[model samples]
Target: NTVPIYEGYAIPHAIQRIPLAGKDITEYLRGLLKERGYNFTTPAEIEIVRDIKERLCYVVHQNFDAVLKESVENTSIEKTYDLPDQRSIVVGNERFRCPEILFQPKHAGLEIEGVHKYAYDSIMKCDVDIRKDLFSNIILAGGTTLFEGIGERMWYEIHQLASSNNKIKVLAPPERKYSVWLGGSILAALSTF
Candidate 1:
């Protein structure tokens, strides 16, 4: 969920939560593995899937349809990931398709709005005077946001949703995965009380 902070306080505006998250992408990739004739019902297997997703999955900004079609043909876009058993699995479309859920949740059977819509909606719910500030200070902090191209894709999508005159700036720090913890530590260090 995207929270708008104003005047050093988080404003209780649009607090939207969706079923779409990092786990959803992992689950989607797991399903793909199953379709490829790989049986994985054990927790250990699930961990392997999660590891593969974290290590290899990435977002694609363009040619999504081409990637999907080419993936089926086992094109050059495919990557081989060696499992602990010395067997390797070919990964292709799953790389971008899984992350595509962030932009189009319906692709993963989720009925909720995409991240771009959520962010725009949240800013719209805020006062018009602060909408620009909200757009300028957009901070993306989460494990899911760490995927390569996620920040770029988000900026492109949100920019499309926002007015042309409104400057949209999304901040995705390198250490975004631990942003909440780091933020708390900073607050604690700066607190006089």
Candidate 2:
């Protein structure tokens, strides 16, 4: 909401990168399709499933388990996508469940933690005096952040980790898919980066 007076990461140790990303979500969606009796056996078929993830998968704002149950009882969250073969797949809880791995990698059989934890830990690694500032200025950029509701989910999860008195804000820009490129472009334009 306020103008940026300064933008820099003073504590390198506070920087973090989660092992998960968009490709993982795509693959997980493919697996979910298989579980639902749609066998995507070829690499080309995998691309179709990737398209399904792009169009259908989304992060849930509520508890993953709760939304899954609600989806079953509500049916509105479900989507049906047409395949190249003239057939179609009914995307149900898999819509949210596939992206759930970003928050709960165990679903993908990975012991790693969620993306929010990386941000929380990064803030905690910094000087206590600036932790609040970091939380209020969190930036979510990359192809993975393109999932609908993903930014909101990150805010919710990070808020759960901080004190109630603290505020959490996440910025997901419109061109976040090229965030790195944009940042580099800005730096390149600068005489001294």
Candidate 3:
């Protein structure tokens, strides 16, 4: 990609206007430096310290890039590069489907391509062969799964992904938002834990 880097005297003014989480860049940096034990004895000292630190960090990262490149080559796994417009493309052996998994986990398979499928697989992998079993009871919790339509989508995906002979049952809490924290609280209360 041809990304542009700003380098003139006017770059500071440009950077000052950049917004992050509703705050400007200069305001964010000023607040960050204030929290990081940086007190302004003089304006010159502040600039000098910031410049030195920035240069040092840049130099360290520049040296590390060669090492990173060499390490990446040693791995046998092929990598995928998913474009913004193309989400469901698989470049190597690994599939690179993104938001589509909310609809079709079966498109990936039994091994579980990603997080949602992993959740489905974990429940399905339980011991169902026992005569008296607690295998039917399965729960889904966590902030990531608390998104709108996520619970039902996951349920449908699990059933769709399963083989014809197998069935999956995943029960999500009514308040999926606080389920993980509630589970943690229960675990902490247990004397056995």
Candidate 4:
């Protein structure tokens, strides 16, 4: 229990409580072992486990605090009247939009930046010509990509990330979010892939 929690388990509170409250089956089993002449486990092992678990919990909390501080300090959304209509707003940029941050730890959040890099990497694994064509026709087909300016943002970022010579474009179907579902229905109706 301590080992698992110390290794940055997501819900350490629930984990810690289960053993102390006698609500965890695994904890009960461990206690049963101790009662059954398994006195081989010394006090030193218990102390060691406790120390490691506390250290892990501290590390995760500290990192979370740092990321929160960085986000607060760097990203601020302003709704000032910067446009003719007096309704323009500016949303600050943060590490969250940087897809590379997903695979690599940024500030403190768990690495899983976004899908772009994953998709790009997957495409790169294909045959050279296929990969080239894939890159040429890269499309973000998902419901979450429906944010108002997401298409343009993705186009700019991905173009910057990819080779300067390779043309990068983000194609949005009419009703972009539902395009995949509509395409699936069309394909199924036509008995096509």
Candidate 5:
């Protein structure tokens, strides 16, 4: 295990990537729409599916099954979005389900494990002295992290997996998708660089 450095410090013994990514979530959304008989199979049609995700996807914290159950009994939980062709799609559980793959991969039909556990295991492999600091400063970056409530869900899941004694915090900047580049640019411009 080898942890990558962030802001100039190495995080030893913690460098494995969770295979899931933003594209995976896009594909998951595409598949969901297709399954609902939306016929978003063509390359062009898939773009519409991506738009749906950007506009509506958000993670749900805990009680995923219960929320799904409630969705079936309550039609109001769903939202409708207008397509370019003047048609519309009724988005239901797919909103939360799309992002849910990052949290509960298997429960969302993904073959891989959950990201929260991946994070927990990686942190556990680090030196005990900095584990608490690491846990309390978890940052979620990248386009996929743009999803609403993802940070909260991440904290919830990681907190559930981590020992109760340590405090956990997950932070996602407002411009998460660009924050990495922005940080790198700042670093490159610094005298230390």
Candidate 6:
């Protein structure tokens, strides 16, 4: 979830933006499918790629290289997803690799820091006294953070960079994807005369 980091005085610090989100992952998966000789140019086919990403893509916190190697070797990691057209495609590393782009944008050919670094860096730019609070109240709200293991991975990465005295907490609400709209609704309600 991307957001503008602000200090205790409401001073804007930094904005954490993810360059390789779901859409980019879908495009990357499409490229991989094309390389595997599965050509798809139609709009329906594009939707299939998005479906596959949403239904299958996940984050791998550890042993990423091993999983990729197993996928390349055509091992048990592979699973066939049947499409609406009755066609099936084998998905292995693509599942984790796509989401991995969030943690490692270099995988998607992007030269930017990962989400964890972005968060930590933004917090660091803020005043020292409030850093602890910022670290403790991390709110993850977005479709990308909904991916399985994403919150855990983000917590781990951020925790690794945080001081021992700092309490790190990463919260991803159940309705995280709609959090922005929900927040707007709350503001409107409270501000109404």
Output the number of the TM-score-best candidate: 1
- Please tell me which model should have the higher lDDT, number 3 or number 5: 5
What range of 10 consecutive residues in model 5 has the weakest lDDT sum? Answer: 1-10
- lDDT for each residue of candidate 1 in 30-137, tens digit (9 for 90 to 100): 887788787667899988888889988888876677768777877676778889999988877777787888888878788888888988898899899999998888
The TM-score obtained by model 2 is: 0.91
Q: Which candidate ranks first by lDDT, i.e. highest?
A: 1
Q: After superposition, how far is residue 88 of candidate 2 from its true place, in Å?
A: 1.8
Q: What lDDT does candidate 2 reach at residue 122?
A: 78
lDDT, model 1: 0.83
Compute each candidate's TM-score over C-alphas. Answer: 0.92, 0.91, 0.36, 0.44, 0.91, 0.87
Give model 2's clash tally: 0
Encode model 4's per-residue lDDT on 117-186: one tens digit a residue: 5445555555555445555665555444433444565556556567777676667665755765876688
Number of the candidate with higher TM-score, 1 or 5: 1
| Tens-digit per-residue lDDT, 82-189, candidate 6 | 988798988777778888877788887889888889888878877797788888888888777778888888888888888899999988889998887897788678
Evaluation by TM-score, superior candidate among 1 and 6: 1
lDDT of each: 0.83, 0.82, 0.37, 0.39, 0.81, 0.79
- Writing each residue's lDDT as its tens digit, candidate 2 over 1-193 gives 1112125534766667677878888888888888889988789998998888888888988688877777778978778899888988789889889999988999999999888887888788777887778888887777778899998999999899999978899998999889879987997999876
Arranged by lDDT, best first:
1, 2, 5, 6, 4, 3
Off by over 4 Å in 5: 1-7
User: Candidate 6, overall lDDT?
Assistant: 0.79
Model 1 lowest lDDT segment of ten = 11-20
* Preferred candidate (lDDT higher): 1 or 2: 1
Model 1, position 17: C-alpha lDDT score = 63
